[model samples]
Target: MVEITNMCRTTGCAIGDIKLYCAGFTSANLINPLIFRHLPTPNHDYCIVNNGNPLSAGAVLSFHYDNTFMYRDFSVSTVTCIS
Candidate 1:
């Protein structure tokens, strides 16, 4: 399992580029294999992850989601953990 500190070490990636990333926890073994794509929008506010591929752990995982437009700092609207 890659550490959270290791996953996405860089900052500010464009919406639709091939990003080299790493993930935290063994679960990433299951979620990091597939390619991720962010949809185009008027404001690069959020991205939709395609989930034709299914992901699961023995236990259900819940992600805390949030959105921000007030700050100019980088943010990702949504992310799909996949493998």
Candidate 2:
């Protein structure tokens, strides 16, 4: 699940050009494939990914966005492990 917040108070940004990528433990060293493309947004969108496989330990997930004009890129990562 991804929640994007537009910090721009006066102007809304476009998130439709973003890309999501994922790679499991076995492929950690290699670049992962594009899991999702062109996320839908309605200004401050909360997106849930349902098509990809469940994430396991040592899995890495990332997103890429193109910053053009007045847009800035933001990246965040969170990890949780259960024993």
TM-score for each predicted model, relative to the true structure:
0.23, 0.28
**lDDT accuracy of residue 1 in candidate 1:** 16
RMSD of 1: 15.2
TM-score of 1: 0.23
RMSD of each: 15.2, 14.6
On residues 3-82, what C-alpha lDDT tens digit does candidate 2 reach at each position? 43423333233222232322211221332244433234543222223223334333344544332332223232222222
lDDT of 2 at 43: 39
Residue by residue across 1-65, what tens digits does model 1's lDDT show? 11111143234321222232212112222342333323344543443332223323232222322
Top candidate when judged by TM-score against the true structure:
2
Best by lDDT: 2
User: Which pairs of residues collide in candidate 2?
Assistant: none
Steric clashes per prediction: 3, 0
lDDT values of the candidates? Answer: 0.29, 0.32
